[model samples]
Target: MHVIIFSWEYPPRVVGQLAEYVRLLAAELVKNRVDVHVVTYHDFLTGAVEEPDGVKVFRVANPVRTHVGILTWALTLNQEVERAAASIYYQVGKQVALVDVHDWHFIPAAVTLKNAFGLPFAYSVESLEDHRAPPANTPYSMSIKSIEWLGFYEAQRVCVKSEWMRDEIVRIHAVPKGKITVVKPKANSWIRDILAMYKSMAGGAGKN
Candidate 1:
């Protein structure tokens, strides 16, 4: 299966554990004979390269350096993400299986690609704005929540690391329980489980 992964962080640009987590996941997916492509952010080091592990990496830098907050930064950076993913779509003969987005950061780009090219995407929940900033009723927080909601609404499937997180997503976003899958990160069957989800989503591609 061929899949594209979207994450805000990856190896050599670690802000937290998620970067390393995604790196390992990509490598494992490649090990399972899945063609994996990652589009991520790097401030200075930006471009595409094939990692020795057989995972393809595409790093993009934010066009606007200055932003009042992460919302603006991610919004501007998503354009680059969309462009990079689109280029891959064409270069690969438009035969991509599906896009597995790692978080809410690149939801807009995924949504756009889905609508424009019939490429289905799965939303991999890392963290939610509601938990990041409690009482997410304020205008700023609501905007982020709206993006998260969009991802849940548009995604062919939603993945979370735990059952509690899956419940929280259903409670906060009203997503159906069947739509969320609790796939433990780095579990013995982690690669197998995620590949199953990818195949399920890919099977239903262009139906969205």
Candidate 2:
């Protein structure tokens, strides 16, 4: 199976847990013989394209370097990511079976591609914006929450790192219990196995 992943960071561009999480997961997917391609924000240090591991990597420019806050950064970055993804999609002949997005940062791109290509997308919810911010929601925090909710709404399946998170998602977002899954990352477990199970249940929904 082939999977296209959109993230805000990747190896050598690591900003936090998401970069490491995606790197390890995508590498494991490659080890399992899955076609894995990653599209992420290009830092000034890394080139536009490269293949550090077995995974194909594409890096695009982050729209602005100014400090406009997380909301603006995410929005601008998503636009660039979507443009790059569209170019890569047609360039590669659109062999991508599905889009696996990491968080709200990738929502705009993932949703755009899903609509353009009729492919299903999965949301890997690491955390909730509301939970991350202070009790009183500001405009910035609300923007993040809105984007996060939209992502949960659009996903064909939602993968959470823990059962607590799954419950939180259901409670906060009102996503059906059946659609949320607790797919905890484990050193002993193969991401391929988990992904295979997901695909088996996903059926034709994930493919174009």
- Give the TM-scores of the predictions, in the order they appear: 0.96, 0.90
Q: Looking at candidate 1, what is the lDDT of residue 26?
A: 94
Error of 2 at 55 (Å): 0.8
* Candidate 1 residue lDDT tens string, 26-54: 99998899889999999988889999999
C-alpha RMSD for every candidate: 1.4, 2.1
lDDT measured at residue 30 in model 1 versus the true structure, 0 to 100: 89
CA lDDT scores, all candidates in order: 0.92, 0.78
- Per-residue error for 176 in candidate 1, Å, reads 0.8
